[model samples]
Target: MKTLLGSQDNWDVVENGHEEPVTTEGYTNAQLNALKVVRAKDKATLYLLYRAVDKSGFEKIANAKSSKEAWDILEKAKNGDERVKQVRLQTLRGEL
Candidate 1:
């Protein structure tokens, strides 16, 4: 999946997430163009993520607004929360 996303030049967007360009009264053509590009990439990456997950995973990310959100949902579901991980590690080391 990482390889596929990287090939499409969308890995960065998925990994870092994008800051939506703000449009204002003073917005320039360049900003509008950048906004279009950002939206397009966000949708594309979201589509890829939606297709990659199974039914259960799909449920977790169904309302995600961006690919990064969907990716984070799957990551947390698979690896658990950071606190959970810490507790698990401590138990394994007989310190919990």
Candidate 2:
């Protein structure tokens, strides 16, 4: 299955113990607008694959905070890590 998240998360909102808050208590118009763009981008990326998920599949990613997290969840659930995929490939080659 194709991973929904694109390679690299450029707009990281969360860090060690701090997160970019949606609250704009004392921000200029430009900062607020930029924040809005970041939020929209994050949400849009998350929903890109979310909307395509079937009802049962939706449950697996309903609470994902970012696209990468959601994509990883789906990948892991499908068949496990890269090692597993390589093993499966070898098995199929042998069978054939």
Candidate 3:
């Protein structure tokens, strides 16, 4: 007598044989974690920028008080501030 295997079992085997697909734009969990760390570093840079500016100026952007906020700030700065632009270039070059 022969035993029969279902399609679901065959699909499972195929899925198991392949590496898990990257969930976000080909980025794995480790890559995402690293990106989070980079965002945190960028946030620190924004904090430094806020310190350089006046208290009120700092508060205006401080509402975005997290890494994502800092990233947005950095993006804006890159467009308007020479220093920030340099930092952004360095970051893209993996030199920061």
Which has the greatest lDDT?
Answer: 1
Question: What TM-score would you give candidate 2 relative to the actual structure?
Answer: 0.54
RMSD for all candidates, in order, please: 3.8, 5.7, 20.9
Give the lDDT of residue 66 in candidate 3: 53
Candidate 2 local lDDT, 22-94, one digit each (tens):
6789999998898777777667766765876787668999988876677667777776657788999999999
- Alpha-carbon error at 23 in model 2, in Å? 3.8
In the range 39-82, model 3's lDDT, one tens digit per residue, is 45544544554665566556556776553453456456546778
Evaluate residue 32 in candidate 1 and report its C-alpha lDDT on the 0 to 100 scale: 77
Clash pairs, model 1 backbone: none
Which candidate wins on TM-score?
Answer: 1
Count of clashes, each model:
0, 0, 0
Candidate 2 stretches with Cα past 4 Å from truth are 1-19, 78-96
- Where model 1 places Cα greater than 4 Å from the true spot, the runs are 81-96
- For each candidate in the order shown, give its overall lDDT on alpha carbons: 0.87, 0.66, 0.50
Model 3: weakest 10-residue lDDT segment is: 1-10
Better of 1 and 3 by TM-score: 1
How many clashes (backbone atoms < 3 Å, residues ≥3 apart in a chain or on different chains) does model 2 have?
A: 0
Candidate 1 residues 1-96, lDDT tens each? 899999999998898897764545687899778778878998999999889888998999999988898898889898876778888888999963
Cα miss at 33, model 2 (Å)? 0.2
